[model samples]
Target: MTILNNKESMRVTLKSVTVPSIPLAALLVIACSGLWFSSYWGARLALFPNQTTEIVNHLQKIIVPNTLLSEIISFFLTLLNAFLLAQINNKFTIIRTRTFLPILVFMTLMGTWNETHLANGSHISLTLFILSLFSFFSMSRNRNSSEQAFMGSFLISISSILINPLIFLIPVCWIGFGMFQSLSLKTFLASLMGGLTPWILYLALNFIINPHFNVLQALILNPNFVLDISTYSLPDLVYFALMSIIIIMGIVGLYSTAHSDAIDTRNKLNFLVFLLISLCVICFIFINQFVSFLPIIALVYALLFSHPLTLKQNNFHSILFIVFCVINLVYAVSKYILT
Candidate 1:
């Protein structure tokens, strides 16, 4: 009985720390800023692909990697993403409570990954993807969802111009619209039109600029399906394995307690789960080609993971959260300081 009481007290203490408050938010900002600075300094440890798509190549020519301007842009974009994440949770109540834990988790994930400290096409694409979610979630049970569908798919189509593999998400978004009961013939046609509009405009612009330009070839998604796990360093492999475990735990926790949420909230959360799974598959298949998608993946993981971490008041979850934070710190130290 005494041991049980002590464990309960510990759980309560940890739960209080996880609560969303102004002081906690400020502290997180300071800590994440420090981490981001360290990551920027250790950017040399990141392994970038030698060759990339023509669009990304063009983007790099403008952004110019390893520059202070690029790092500053990336940092501000991360902050913007954190703000958007908090807004998404507050607007939709996806976590069933008003909390900033998603922002905390997301910033921690972003700061730990050295590769994300540089401005890239993936950063821009992720911002667009999250914006699309705002439109997509608003379409739940909305009778006139054609406009939202168009806007959402239009944003995603623009994102695909940067990260070509993201084009596959259009079908996933359509399936999500079906789950939300907002998929009608009109909305379907609108989404289809929205998905094609960007490509059409890009093709036309390219034709006007250079009639011989091969826009179709530029749009092709050439994913390297080979799983080259052996290429990763020991620390990277361990870090990735830990992240995979956290993802599995979050998914299991979500399904275990999903019945408690409101129907609307549940449907929205289900769409997130479906979208997260689809993104994971895309990442797995195209990891070599599109590692920039990590920030987007981290965004979804933070949302799903926060649900159970913030709500579950058990000692097991509290301990898990503590371990999660410690692991992130250690990984950051290993990459940025030790290396």
Candidate 2:
């Protein structure tokens, strides 16, 4: 009869490979590198500009497509965003542990898809939104955070100029402030002022540069309320479904472990959950229009996924993580190799 010993069991169990270890870090690096190469290869072979690229080109009066330079810029921007994500978690302890899992997960997700390889308005908007989050998360439990509120709203407004759909995030920020217990009449007014500042400046600049700039034409607020799944292949749909399942698991892990966290941490996690739901709703309502926002969605998804994959050390979660990695690999192969 064959029997398994403790050492052999430990070798098979993922709990033995904790987050802050060298093996996990090396594995993350290898996986991200492979995924990045696949995406880069795909983008190099074909550069397709979606609707968001056209809108951005029209608004800016400059054609910026997915070129080598744009791809490089997008890659660097993603790295910067990953660093900022890690910083947010470290500074706020949002994940309740000091782990680089967020960065790893974020970079891996960014590398998984070809659409994210191009430097577009969405990348710029996501960068600004993350910068704003630094201020928003910092305002926790501080009623006198009007300055932070203004800065946060200001950055978000600037991002909205790049991606009009993101303007909805202004109200989301207000709701987040309320959740953070930092909302006040003063902060509310400041946030409004901050949100309007970009538009005011944009209008003024357009007036000086060209009086017939047609602000209404530039600020197109069209929303096609359609569940546009026609663009996605069966494999793509399956990959998204798997990702959704992981996100659901992360949400469950978050709530199941909520009582162990501090009040501030709980509030922040709740805000993240709310923000993720809001993004999903926006994506669903305007999938065709907001396709560029996938990178932003990936950012939030990575953070949420990191919660469970980092904290929950069980056979189920471990197997889930392994499955997640394998799915990504298979999807990449199907996307870049098979097709």
Candidate 3:
């Protein structure tokens, strides 16, 4: 593909993506735009493939290794998860279910890179990814869901970390997601530790089996780690800032919805999720070396768990989200193209 000038590229983008759902499609559009956006940064970051810059080559690298269509599928799945969850909350009158969808968001990061720059393989073989969704639905057959759902989620998260140990931190997401429920210290701790335990077991197994994999050091730190440009963008920073506001609005909305009585389970859980995400984000800010993926985790949850709004309300915020996404992509592109 030729490096058309910026105006030409933008025109081509509009031509390729003209649609009736321009407003709604913006969200998905921005995602493809993001991949296009990453083309620039992929060249600049140029750490992976570890060689000279190549913009078109970088764009071609859209699909991560070992997960050919993971990005596209994950994005679509994220949409399905969000909508189904909102419907679940409305129907069951129970928001504490800890449905498998939130966990799916975290586990999908397995398709992402790691600190050692290894692909961090999953527990199940490649075929099991689809089965994960099946298991989630299958648990409904017997109606024994809470423990089973979480247990399935636990196994999946564990498998995810094995694929890439850094993913352990993703449960920081579960910790957040759990907040909109009971808020018991015991249950919350279980969620937190459950997310981490896989990596611990991974370390233990490696220590006992390999005896010299430097499992602890690798898990603790990665001296040679280079930032995954696929993960971040300066423009997205604005969206993150908006995400903070969305969280704030979510809190206010929940509070208003709660009417400040004795504080319901939903409110408690919401508080927990918000606090946990905040903690995760703060920790990453100080220690980016440890969890470069925190923003992705935080942003996903923020997008997932925001207060339920009407069609217009959702459309409104979705617009804000897309605008921020667009800015981030443009900045990412500039970083790529200018450098």
Candidate 4:
């Protein structure tokens, strides 16, 4: 019985080691392939947009070309992204447990789907933000120094915008990522260049696809740009409000945690605070699409900070925060195109 159990354990460990590499490569192939389709089709809903929709519509545009170089490149980028995001946990305090992966894969798939599906509505502006949130949660489960944590964040932000340039909004994280990593200026510039490289390619591709590139249109910044918002139903408003309340409480938790005397957790808590502030600014400057991006980041930060707030401490504020998310989600049911 012991020998059989040991054999099973060894097989499981070996398989676990090998499986992530292939699926990770496959995921990036699918994600990058989604971008290729985006170029050809323009981000649009043919008939289905939801993840719950038929798999054919969602996966149809993703073509895994079997070329060696393309596959290798796809594989490497995905590995780097995943490593920056989740590999720290195994490397540091270095747990041998296999539980972290399912959640990681789930988020990767959902996040990629969100990025791809929403490309038309909210993808471009929120690009850096959404990817940063995904990376934050992925790394939240690890043991990393302040510097390592910062670099991980920086690289993720820089890497995210490589696919979508509008992500330049999270410059704070890119800067912080570099600073936290204690990287030399050359390495920092190299990563920054890497981030912008995709956008440069995007322009070249634009020229190839359309000879007379609308240089003026691409460069023009509306001096008085305002978002165009459609009407929202009552339920949509409710859900939006509920989501907001939950977020505020989470931020409050972050503040409480950051001020702690515990030196160990201060830096991470502070990092979360920095992320929240940056996210808030993006929400203000860019678009309201940032609301959904808030809850998860806040929740993850709350977990890291772990400052339990009692109703006695601030009853009214706590109640209001919880109320907001409920109202917001309710509103979203009727008003939102994406759930």
Which candidate gets the maximum TM-score versus the true structure?
1
TM-score of each: 0.92, 0.89, 0.46, 0.45
Clashes of 3: 11
Clashes of each: 0, 0, 11, 22
lDDT of 3 by residue, 52-104 (tens): 11222343366453242533444454344344444543443323332322322
Instruction: Give the lDDT of residue 107 in candidate 4.
Output: 30
| C-alpha RMSD (angstroms) for model 2 | 3.5
Query: Which 10-residue window in model 2 sums to the lowest lDDT?
Result: 10-19
Whole-model lDDT, model 3:
0.39
Which digits, one per residue and each the tens of the lDDT, describe model 2 over residues 109-200? 77777666653677778899999999898888888888999999999999887777788888998999999999999888888999999989
TM-score of 1: 0.92
Model 3 ranges off by over 4 Å: 1-153, 156-201, 213-265, 268-276, 294-326, 329-333
Quote the positional error of residue 177 for candidate 3 in Å: 10
Candidate 4 per-residue lDDT, tens place, 1-339, comes to 011145334211222312346676566446545433332243322222222211222333452223333234333433444443344333321122322332333233323332233322222223334354444333432334333334434544443332222354346544444334433554445446644555566567777988998645543322222555454444545544654555566556546534543332444445556666675665545353343333234333333322322211243433443443234333323322442
Clashing pairs in 2: none
**Local lDDT at 146 for model 4:** 37
Off by over 4 Å in 4: 1-165, 178-184, 208-210, 219-230, 233-238, 257-265, 288-339
- CA shift of 243, model 1, Å: 1.5
Per-candidate Cα lDDT values, in order, are 0.81, 0.76, 0.39, 0.39
